[model samples]
Target: MKNFALFLVVCFLWSCNKDDQVETYTYTLGIPETMTKVEWRSQVAVQAPKPIASVGKIYAYQNYIFINEKHKGVHVIDNSDPTAPQVVSYINIPGNEDISIKNDFLYADNAIDLVVFDISNINLIHEVERLEDVFNYYSDYQMPAEVQAADYSNFDADSQVIVGWRVEERTEIVNYNESFFSDNSLATNTVGTGGSLARFQIVNDFLYTVGSFELKTFDISNLSQPNLVNTNTAGWNIETMFHADGFLYLGGSNGMFINSIANPAAPEYVSMFTHWDGCDPVVVDGDYAYLTLRGGNACGQELSTLEVIDISDKSNPTLVAQHALDSPYGLGFKGNDLFVCDGASGLKIYDKTNPLDLQLLHVFSDVQATDVIPLEDRLLMISDAALYQYNYDDQNNIVLLSTFNLN
Candidate 1:
């Protein structure tokens, strides 16, 4: 009778313990892929054309189109003939996401370093100089939530570089009070034209860049030798920048910042215009700044809109109008035609003759547009899957010239 009572007591305790525990739930984590710092720094090559696996920013100089392959390198294409662009060469730049060209010199961000290349001979490009430790974007090394803490547990940052991620699903029991974790996946240039999504912009002799929340200036006054001249805290969550009439317009996650580049080498903050939190890329024409706030993906909020801000008074910018958009990404103006690469909703063309009431002209929903460059002769658009060229000469009937496979 004593043994039976002991067994019952043990069973009851076990039941209570199990009832108090939380159930298991499966979630995915991104495991970081790393390499030795030495190897990453020395890995720069210009070789035969390889298929582009990803798109970061698109830049056009003379007749060549340079497309960034996320954290890998850049794919150089001969766009002399927009009807059919060929992937002529690939510049192997580890952790490259932006590029700009001036006087045949191609400037790019290689990890935390600023690397300059002589691309005068498109087929024979070589590294000319490199400025080391100019950026503090360790955020690039930071993996998405939950997984990031795990990243610190497994990786050593002192001697390694994170180039990519390997996703893995895991199941773990959690208490009722424990919150669920989620992963957030985290140019210029030039004398050449950049898509509105470009962070690197070349204004005359100075090259300016916005990363995270800082503005970095590079004095490329000398075509061959570039110098890091200044660094200023410009805005919060800055995404892209535009230069117009000696002023720099910075688009951030929370607002628009205006800085006067009258000094060129160093920028002075002028004013700010706050907006809904989202990922925005800005472009300016005359006195108005056009911003496309995209909400989704890693961009905060679930609202997408096209906002026009009157910057005639740079110090006190106010909203002109806000129009709903499907998922606006990169945008630019070809004459008075405002072309927006609306994700999923395709190419949205508008008559911006009136900024207050942007007259919607067309929405080409056939393509999943992300970023675009309104070149002098044609329009170059990069989607999730391909590079598309269109002849916007006939505003009434914009024609697709060709589509290059980006897969």
Candidate 2:
């Protein structure tokens, strides 16, 4: 009887403890009275600059690539293969904007001087000579009736008569006087002036450099020293010059100018293709010319568009297609495709397979793309304070592959 009473007492104490632990606690479900959540956020992915990286834009050679940075020198990339590019060396050049290569020589602009580099070696690039004697090549002014005579235009008779509102057409309606300047003293004169070298080209035995107010020609049969041959006043704000087919093309704030270089010592104005405002960044292949219009500084008008023209007939270039874009600065061609360095939209690709019907193929964003050149089969190099490689995939698509930041 005593053992049974002890067991009952232990069971009663355990049940009481379990009941005390099972008691519920009170709580409230409502908004917090002390604070509120802030719902704002930011979005901007930035990458820090790396050492030994390319600085500005990039130019391509058969075996290597050249990249330009603002204050740093040019970076050379080994491109034995398209997909995998590695840096080889850095060629020190300050204030460089762009580069062009021909016959183992490299040409670059230092804003104040037109520089020529000895690039015979893919491993080392050295500055050989600089010409600061360019004068009267370019300006930011309107083309006079005498100068505009060589440009093609579609202006109505009334438009030409309108004083301030007329779109000064660029193309000349009449054929140039072929016999007028053959015996002129100006054809064989040597004139030197202090001008900016905006664009240059070497065709045949002649070297052409576009200056602030005139197009200057030199005899380059002697490669080491270029002798001034002749100069012709072309246009204002001259942006770029190119030789295609049998003609030489000039880009200006005014429009596109075409001249026959069949006689290099005496190039005659053939025609002009007019854009709404200023046309810049010209690239050409065969019968087609690609250009960008970055609008005007004056308030009355501005143009933001890409223009493709057909120059089969040198004296009457025709506009085939146009596409609107942001501040465009550079143009490049690979096969039948066109690449534009649109200021804000990055690098844009288009199919010029049908020059008359240009189609947008792809775009790589955030590049601030200023210039583009093909590297090989499916890769390209872009410039924007550094050199970048972009690749096209099996699906015929484009993607940013690598970046080399030059700081």
Point to the candidate with the largest lDDT: 1
How would you encode candidate 1's per-residue C-alpha lDDT over 159-239 as one tens digit per residue?
A: 666777686766655565555333221100011111223378898999998887689999998867888999999777677
Our model 2 lands, by Cα RMSD against the true structure, at: 29.5
C-alpha positional error of residue 260 in candidate 2 after TM-score superposition, expressed in Å: 1.3
In order of appearance, the predictions have TM-scores of 0.83, 0.62
Model 2, runs deviating above 4 Å: 1-57, 69-77, 80-99, 108-115, 122-197, 296-300, 375-379, 392-395
lDDT of 1 at 7: 7
- Mark the regions of model 1 whose C-alpha exceeds 4 Å error after superposition: 1-33, 145-159, 164-198
Any residue pairs clashing in model 1, and if so which? 187-199, 187-200, 188-200
| CA RMSD per model (angstroms) | 10.2, 29.5
Q: Which ten-residue region of model 1 has the weakest summed lDDT?
A: 2-11
Error of 2 at 9 (Å): 99
Backbone clash tally for model 2?
31
